[model samples]
Target: MNLRDIDLNLLLVFDRMLAERRVSAVAQSLGLSQPAVSNALARLRRALGDELFLRTAQGMVPTPLAMQLAEPVAAAMSALHGALNQSTAFDPATSTRSFTLAMTDIGEVYFTPRLMERLNQVAPGIRISTVRNTAVNLRDEMEAGQVDIAIGLLPQLKAGFYQRRLFMQRYVCLFGKQHPLAAKSRLTLKDFASADHVLIQAAGTGHGQVDEQMAAQGIARKVRLVVPHFVAVGHILQSQPMIATVPEKLARALAEPFGLAVRAHPADLPQVAINAFWHARFHREPGNRWLRELLTETFAEG
Candidate 1:
């Protein structure tokens, strides 16, 4: 008989009736009516093309075919019971799950080291894989469970995604510590406008707004170099006298390591809010919830 033609629930009745030997006991044990139990047994007999059980003064007697299926069917039900009772909670320390995060270069620079340190302490078995949001479709990746979380200033993650603000970061000017303008207590508007700039056109990450806002304030800089990401900006600024206007977090991290100095932007520029974003599909997932909480506890500003 085709497997599709049989209802697996019918197997439950067969196993119960075999041990109880009476339709009344099988119906009470299964919380099914006697008529339902009898009907299920009839369906099972017809599908197997045998009289699985025969009625007798002793309540019911199993046929040879029923005796043959008794062990396997009972074993299958026991396994299903165990599976249905298994715990569904996610234990970070025990889980070897690898999560994919979507981030910008700046996010990688600011968030990864500390995150790894925290994970190593509490969730050493868990691993992280990062993908550039620019290289992949952020929405599609999160939807498909390919990317677990995205952390940065991603305007594209809006419309259908959920987000939580981690902190606010201000824009500042970064330059070599030994640059001529470094000795000044505060950079003047002229110093900002006339200085040669390293324009970081971080197109996909939405950091291009820094330049747009600068232009809107009529504070235009003389850009001597153009680059795509903040990852290499520190190294370039260490050797070059040109300025890179970047977020305060990146500036703070790169300043001491790269022999760079940070100065507040002379013109008014709005601060950007860094946020953690995920698709609604994974909002209640245990792993996703754990990661989201870890980020908030580790980095979120009060």
Candidate 2:
């Protein structure tokens, strides 16, 4: 079938339908009515001479032809989107676009306040919203233009995207000011192993690298608590005689506020590089470029 013969707009519907297998979801994401999405699917089916997707109880299951066409169609759509947005001018002060960013808990703590401050002063109308990186598939969401950019140690956003390193941070042990280890400027391996630990399994991020690095050296800490986020670690350490391993910069931020003391990690952990990732489709998008440049300028460590 010749591409020119079919309505190119139908391809947009087809692509979204593939990403979100349900008609209702496609409709919601595309800002169209459920019937409208179904109608477009019907027209595409007639034009293509194939039942591209089979309606099933679970979701709209793609047929063999749909599966075959998915990649090329997605690529073409992305390229076309890039081309359309390439020349558009983005005036931050005047634009009222709301951009959704994917971030981990630590990322929100480190990035949000600063970003908001700068944005409020410069781009007062533009809005910023955030979603947990673990909550959505970063690659898929970014490719679909649902997520503007992701920040943190997202190792999954590798292929088909661009990444810029904001900074490298080593792990530090945060201890209560009154804790026995806090007396020492730096912690020793013996102090680390003897103390009960609050392990922040910052899932969906590269925080696990800390654990792996520790294990490689045969250093084992007594895991007293395992939390999923970094928010409460400072509070936990403040009240308990526990050492929490965390990013050095974050540790310093929490030290005085939480009555916690930051010390060099007893174990030599690999430095984790925090990065910003955006899909190639939106690499040249004027607004996207502005946001990423804002992130770099505000946070990049020399």
Candidate 3:
């Protein structure tokens, strides 16, 4: 395997393939076609004299050879990127750099519009992309720089990471203003448990904070509908007597527009912290620092 026979671009493709494990996803990230990514992988396989990856039901599975190469290659690329950014200044007004944020659907609904509007006003040329923030993949994505910043409820940061608290999200009960529950000035735990509920099972975890708090008191509410996000809660509330427990930020944002009413949650569930996370490697990168600061300022306004 002669170094002269290898293309540096192929290594980049390989690196992204290791992160994404799918040709199409890697192509989208690199702005290349699926065929082009496939062709690059073929070249990489031939040059390296091994099947770097294998297609599997999960997507592309890295071979032992690829797994062996992943860490050093990622380190080299990260260091090169850091060094290049250090050598130059990032002028948000002029930089055409793209930022990828890892977040959940709720985060997208609550944060994207404001963030994009702010960026358009100050950094018009900058582009933003979002990836689903699954608990399983966030750390690896951040480490590889596939995701620039992650927002929402993040895992506890180990060393070599930076995180800032954006806000603490408290849950509130939401119902249509015309619903029977809306007549009550104060809602009790029994009142909450008696109502048919619309559960926003965003994580597919079968249960949520509401359930945990209710179980502690040995109470259970019947879930009449289960949906993945707060967006669906509005529509369900409009047509049914069902109640939903959602983040205060979401309830406040939608209550007026959706003609819904918010009530304090009767259950004493703890508020969760919404946070922003970035790698220590990107902590000093001017563009990342700018973005982190922008996110901090933008969400703090909410």
Candidate 4:
């Protein structure tokens, strides 16, 4: 426990190991060989007097002590990184950093085009990659610096994460312009319950907010189609007379392209709070902050 005896570099390795539990991956990230990483871990174990990580079939699992040390160590590393890069100018036009984003199908449909357009004009050298946001393992990935930011409804993001609200979305019914219900100004509960519906099944087995709200009132929708993603909703509605309840932004985006119509859902469903989520460790990162600022300005519908 002597501060003078500890090598600060060892703490850096410890922090990386806490984020990326695998030794080989940590070595690759840190530009060290496999033996070097193992040697560092051995030193950390002796210095801390605890076997911080345990190797299992699933990879390295952090012990309770390691979990307890994760936040403070990560925060320290982040602070040091920011301090070291404080004077470094972040010129978007000259930077060639790649950022990975996590979002749902609806989110990708709504945000990617706008974000890409802005980046293309201003930050030509920057690159972007996307992954679906399941709100699962998101925290670990963000902490590990794998996902730069996630754009969607992340009500489950924990305390150490940072989030900024971009806009508020509401459920709207989508159907082909020629469908029978398209002429209705606003749908009624009876009309909604009786219509053939196309439900977007993003998760394996779950219902949308509209369906849950309807069920609360003892109404059951006759869902005739269940698709795995929101992209299919537009195509299905274009060819069939099925109604789909989707986010307002998504409905509007596809309305003209697919020749579809949008209407307010009959039941009063809760408005979706769309936000950008990232770990606090990346909050002050130069490139990450730039992307966040750009997204906040681009989707500033609140």
After superposition, candidate 3 runs with Cα above 4 Å error: 1-84, 156-160, 204-207
Off by more than 4 A, model 1: 1-87
The TM-score, computed over Cα atoms with residue i paired to residue i, of candidate 2 is: 0.84
- In angstroms, the error of model 4 at 9 is 2.4
Q: Give a tens-digit lDDT track for model 4, residues 56-119.
A: 9988999999889888888888888889888877899998998999988887788899889999
lDDT of each: 0.85, 0.86, 0.82, 0.85
Q: Rank the candidates by lDDT, best first.
A: 2, 4, 1, 3
lDDT of 4: 0.85
**Cα lDDT tens digits for candidate 1, 1-302:** 67688899999888777667789988998899999998998888888899988989977898999878865775576557546644568899899999998888888999999999999999999999998977645665675468999999887776446899999999998999988999987999998888899999987887888888878878878989999888999999999899989999999999999999999889888889889998665666678879999999999996
Maximum-lDDT candidate: 2
| Cα lDDT of model 3 by residue, 1-302, tens digit | 67687998999999889878888888999999999999999998888899999888998888998888876776667677777778778899998999999887777778998999999999999999998776576776787677899887755455456788898878889999998889998899889888999877777322265567768888688888888766677778877888998888888877887899999988888888888888765776788999999998888635
**What are the TM-scores, per candidate, against the unseen true structure?**
0.71, 0.84, 0.72, 0.91
Point out the worst 10-residue segment of candidate 2 by lDDT: 135-144
Model 2 ranges off by over 4 Å: 1-7, 27-58, 61-72
Q: Supply the TM-score for candidate 1.
A: 0.71
Candidate with best TM-score: 4
Shift of residue 77 alpha carbon in model 2, Å: 2.0
